[model samples]
Structure formats: structure tokens, C-alpha cells
Target: MPRAAIDVISVYVRKAQKQRSRLPSFRSLAALEAVVRHGNIVWAADELGVTPGAVSKQLGSLEEELEAPLFHDGHRLRPTPVAIELAQTLGVALHLLREGWDKATHGLDTGVVTITGNASLCMHWLVPRVLAMQAAAGGRAIRVTSLHTSDTWWQSTVDIAILRHRRVPVGWESQTIGTERLTLLGSPERARRAAERGIAALGGETFLAAETRHGDLDRWLAAAGVGADTERRDSVHFYVAIEAALEDMGMVVAPIALCHDLIAQKRLAAPFPACTIRGAGLAGAYNRAICSPRTAESLFRWMKREMRRCSILPAV
Candidate 1:
């Protein structure tokens, strides 16, 4: 290209870069979001701790950036259709961004990080080991809330969660903790009897069921290529059923990881080899609207490291 043509191109490129750099900052977007949310400049200004004129100037600057009017400045300065739609989405995004910033900069260094999970997990796994995790975190507190196994437990304000989900909800993040597998546990005598009698002999024994995992026995039996014609006896939770099995109540279908300590101690024995069920696993989740990035990252890292050594998680 000739010198003059190259100079013109260079000048245009610099101007474009300058314009791109001038893209609306969070301040202007915040002002716009608040304005659209409140539906009035004065109210938005009050909410943002700024004067109405300042809010209007911010909107004006934003409008210049997009080269489009955002509001119909008629009798009430009504937001246009585009403005309303943009506000609806940007409000959520900006709220999440602000929460992440706050968490990154101002997490409770000495206070508790609340976590929630299913009752079985809290009892059998996390509760026992959380104190060590807390100590590792330099005395930051760890508070756990136990939810019913069937509860849609992820839509909460907790910093972390350990639960099973078919699909995560919108505005949330998740990580796979472990893939669930089932084993039939019983007392020493019962296990030997079942093993000798081809697991079908235990059909008449009391089936200590986990209320949380309805149909778990059926699933386990089917996976082991056995028919499900067993007696129905239910326990409140997995731990309860495991305890019952330890005391020779009945054969219970349980997660292998949860039954490890008992089996190792000879408190419970596997009547049949463990079978990986088709579709069951646990995950950790947090609401993006509430959880800070720093909190989420830290908790995920802590759980990943802890679960690998403690539970039957899939290899990373």
C-alpha cells in the first residue's frame, strides 16, 4: 500500500481501538440497570447513592457508546423496550459480578463458611472429616446443614452443597464429587448365608431400606442380575440402615464408600460384590447469585482434595 493509504488505515485502527476501550464501564451499566429497575432516575440515584443528574449523565454516556436512546424521556422518562430487556439480564449479571468481587476481596477469614448436603452424606462422610478441613483452613468455621435426600436442595444461600442432581439449575455451578455405587451389606452370618445361597436366599431376610434411596435395593438386585422379590423394611436414612445392618437387623443396600469403615471393622459385611448402578452420583453446587467466586473456588478445591482420599470419587 502507498504511504498515504497506510497512514489513513493506521489512524482508523487507532480510533477504533480507542472506541473499543471506551466501552461502557460497570458504573454506567450499574446506573442503567438501577434506573430500569426503579423505573425512575431519582429513585435509581437514591439507591446508588448518587444525584439524579449524575445518574442521567451516566445513562447519557452509555447511550453515546451504543449510539441509541435507552429511555423515552416523556412525561415520566420511561425506559424503552430495549432498555427494559437489557436491564432484566444485566441486573442479574452485574449482581453476580459484584458478589464475586465482594467474596474475592472480603470473605470471612475467621468466620464460618456454611455448607449444605443430603442427610446421608452429612452423617456418614462430611461431618466426621469437616473439623480437619476447618483446621486446614486456619480455624475458619464450617457449618453444615442436612437436607432430605429427595429435596431440591441446591437453590439455597449456602456457600457449598453436596447433593445429587439430574441437571443443575440456571445461575448455578457444580462439580462432580463421586459416582455412586451400591453394595449389599449384612451381618457376618447373613453375608455368608447369602453368598452360599446365591444372594437370592436373602430375599426373605429383612431388607433394611434407606428411605432416602427408595428402590435402591431393587436397583442393586437388578444390577447384580437377581430378581427383586424381597421383604420391605425401611430405615430413616442410609446411616440408620447401616447401623441396623451392623446390629444384624437385615441386609441393606448401601453405598460402598459410606460402608467402608464398617466393613473394614467387621461391623458390616458385603453379602455380594458392589455393583455400579446406572445413574447415581453426588455433586457440589452453589448459587452464582449468592456464592462469591473466592468462596466457591476455595470450597471446591477443599472438597475435591478431601473427597478423593476419603470417598469413592472417580479419579481426576
Candidate 2:
């Protein structure tokens, strides 16, 4: 358990005792926490192994005891400020208690550290270096989960997240992992033609675009000072776009981090290296309330080292 969590719990207990007010039952508090965390009574009830009615009753009991409403009545429950704060504290405390119980029953070092990130990044970057990451973790088991680009950090059950945001979100600790440098990539033969004839050589070729990166092609084109009109094909993901590019379908603008290995293997080529556009800054995020800072830092450092190894240009 973190000392901060212990202190917060102790303070809560002391305040309840001083006021001579009974602390809410553990079940009621758990219900409140789950409901607020999930933002859906049915989901919370499912998590707690109870019916929605039961969860509602628990929430009512808690509200009655405290003489205050915790959630707004709407299609979706919106937690009040107090509810959010209490739920956050309870979340940390409960997670620590669960960890303590797990350690006592299963023994220490039994936990698997889960790292989640963009699916393309996991496939092209992290998956290849997972063994090195594990070794850097001092032999601790590591699990990597790929998340869709639209998935939020709160929706994941990961120990660490490779987030696109440079700023740390509230309630989480984070470190800058890398900057994404979007580069124009294509098949070797197409790249050779472009290198010899400049950007005009690919004017007739299709532009493979990823739906997730809607404006990246235009951005890269503007950065590269190219004004030629070209046909385009859109894919749902960067990986698909890259695959299309590899098959000589079209040129795709992608993060170098995702295509660096292919480039190194001579499977793909960057025709205009100087035209790389700076993209989102990546961060490694973790809940300090539950994750050990030292462990998170170690993993973050390894991630940084690996990214640096694959990067073809300096982050600007």
C-alpha cells in the first residue's frame, strides 16, 4: 500500500470518528465507487455480481446515510465533485488492499505488468522489442495489449499506457516517451523513382491514407512543399495503409517509428527524409496511486531507449 493512501484512509477514519458519524458500509461504498468509475449502473452491478436494482438500492442507502446526492439523475449518471473525490480515494485504497491480499495469497512478484498502446505501435515498435523490455524489467513478466486509436486511458486495464498526450492527465503520472515523426514511405522501386525525379515522379500514383490520420497526408505534403494532385485510397488503420504501400499500391505517410524496421530491412523506403513532419508527442502514463514509481520509470526509460534506437531523425 502507498503511504499516501494509508494516510488518506487514516484521515477519513479519524474524521468519521470525530464527527461520531457511522462510516458507510463497505458494500455501499463499493457500489458507489463502481457506479461512478464505470458511469453505468448496469456495468457496475455486473462488476459487483449484483442486479441493477441492488446497486441502485445500495446507492440510495449511501445517499440517505450521508444526506447528500452523489450522482445526477440522467440517462447516464454524472458524479458530483464529492462523489468523484471519494470514489478516487476509495479506488486507490481498494486497489492497495487487493494488491496486499494478492501478495499474501499468491506471493510477491506474481503480478504481470500490462502495457497498452496504439495497435500499430504495438505491432511495429513494441512487439519487436518486448524481449528487451522484459529483460530491462529485471525478468518480471510483461504483457502488451493493443488498443484502438480511439480507446481512452480509463477504458484500459493496463499498468502503463503509451498515450499520445504530452501533458499528464489528472490522477496519473507520466513521462515523455517519444515524438512521432511522420515520414513519407513507399516501395523501394517507387522510392527510387521519386529520388530520381523528385516528388513529381509519384504524381500519378495513389496516396494511401489512414482514416485515423485524416489530415496527415495533406500536412506532410504541405511540409514537403508538394502541390501535385494525386489519387488517394483510405484504410482504417496505419498498419493497413503501410501494408498497402508495401504492395506497391501507393505512398503512405506514417510515423517513422512504425516503419523504421521495414525501412532498415529494405522492405520500405523513405523517399524524402528531410520532409518528415513532427507529429504527436507520446507519453508513458501510469497511476501513481497503484503503480510503483520506480518500476514505471524503469519501463519508461527502456521505452525511450528503444524509440531512440528506431528514430531516423532528432525530435524537434
Candidate 3:
């Protein structure tokens, strides 16, 4: 949670304490929280084990209790700004309550550390090295999950998160692991052709890009001093884009750490190594309340060391 959100929650708590009799029902609050969090009444109803009509009735009760309009009638229920902030605060509060209950029932140290990151990073980089990371943690079980969004941090039980962020969120600890280096990769034949023709050949070939990294191609081309417009194909994930490139569909600009093994194995080729662009810095973040300091530090060190081992070179 951010500092502003915490302040909002604190103010809400103080008000609720002052007017104890006016506090909304827990069921109504839960319905509001679920509806706002998921942005769908049907989904919230399913999660709460009820029907959409029941959820709607709960929301109406909550709105009447709060004396504020929380949603606007439209094609889809659009939450008002107040509703969004209230839902965020409620989410944090519920997560804290759950954490407290878990801590009370089970001991603090569960002997298992959960790490989460983007799907591409988890698949291409972290999953393959899970055993090594576990060994580094002194035999503690390591769990890795692929989480694509950053907004669900409070809902997750992950101990550490590897994210492409430079700033740490409030009440969490973070350290910069490394700056991701983005390189243009393709099959050997396409790479060899591009290498022979220099940077201009990039304009002639189709560029494969991920929707997650929509601007990478233009950024790389600008860094390489190439201004020509090129055909581009988009994929949902970077790993998918790289996979397409492997099938000789098109060239892809991707993080070297995710493709270095393929490059080393000659399955992929870095056509213009000198044109590599610096992508976002990778940060390892952990909430101190959930992860022990020693465990967080050990995993951070292991991540840094493993990242340092990934080197990109042109395919032989």
C-alpha cells in the first residue's frame, strides 16, 4: 500500500470509530469490496457464494448506509472515485486481518518462501533456476508464481516480488537487482542477414513485439539511429514474441536475461549487439511483515548473483 492510501484508511477508521452505530454491515462491505476489486458484480457474487441480485442488493444497502453514490449506471458498473478508494482501503484492512489470523493460527516462519513476477520472467528466467535458489535458501522450499499485475499485491501471499520498478512501495523493502538490457534477437538466418546489412536491414524485416512491451521496438530503433518504419507483429507476452522469433516469424526486442541461454546455444542470434537498449531496472521487493529480513536478504543476493551470470553475445 502507498502512504496516501494508508492515510485514507486511517481517516476512514477514525470516522468509523466516532460513529460506531453508523458503520456499514460487514456483509455489505464485503460485497462492495469484492465488486470494486473485481469490477464485476457476477464475479463478486460468485466469490461471495451468492447471486448477482444479492450482490446488487448488498451494494444498495451499503450505498444507503454511506449516503453516497458509489457506482454510475452505464454499460458496465463504473465505480466512483470514492468507491475505488474505499475499496482499496477495505482490501488492505481485510488482508491485514487475514494475515493476523494466519499468524495467530500458524507460526510466523512457514519454512517456505513464495516469489512472484511477470509470466515471461518466471517462465524464462526464474523457474529454471528454482532449485539453485532453494539451495541458496538453505533447503527452504521456494514457491514461484507468475503474477502479471501489480495491483493485487495485497491479495497475494507472496514473500518476495521481482518487479520492473525503480521505486519501492510504502511499508515494503526493495533493492535494485539489475537493469534489463534489451537486445534484438531472431533466428540464425534472419540474424545473419541483418548482421550483413547492418541496422538498416531492421526496417526491411518484420519486428515482433509484445503487448506488454509495446514501445520497445521504437525505443530500440531510435537508440540504434534507425528511423525507417517497419512492419510489426504483436504478441501477448515477451516469451511468446521470442518464441515467434525462434520460428523465424520476425525479429524481437527482448531482455537479454530471458534469451541469453538461447543465444548461447545458437538457437537465437543477437544481430546488433552494439545497439542494445537499457530497459527498466529490475527490483526485488518484499513486505517486512511477511518475510523475515534474513530470508529476504538471502533471496535478493541469490537473484543478483544469478542475474550477473547471464551474458549476451552474438550467436557463433
Model 1 lDDT at residue 213: 80
Candidate 1 clashing pairs, residues 3+ apart or interchain: none
- TM per candidate comes to 0.58, 0.62, 0.63
Candidate-wise lDDT, in order: 0.72, 0.80, 0.82
Q: What's the alpha carbon RMSD for model 1?
A: 16.3
Candidate 1 Cα errors over 4 Å, as ranges = 1-104, 108-110, 135-139, 149-157, 166-171, 274-279, 305-316
Q: What's the lDDT of the predicted structure labeled candidate 1?
A: 0.72
For model 3, the superposed segments whose C-alpha errors exceed 4 Å read 1-110, 166-170, 311-316
Candidate 3, run of 10 with poorest lDDT: 102-111
Report RMSD (Å) for each prediction in the order shown. Answer: 16.3, 18.0, 20.8
Which predicted model would earn the best lDDT?
3
Q: Candidate 3, 48: how far from true, in Å?
A: 54
Please, what are the lDDT tens digits per residue for candidate 3 over residues 64-144?
666568898778889987788888888988999888988855543557889988888888788888998888877778988
| Candidate 3 vs. true structure, TM-score | 0.63
Candidate 2, superposed: residue stretches over 4 Å from native = 1-110, 166-170, 313-316
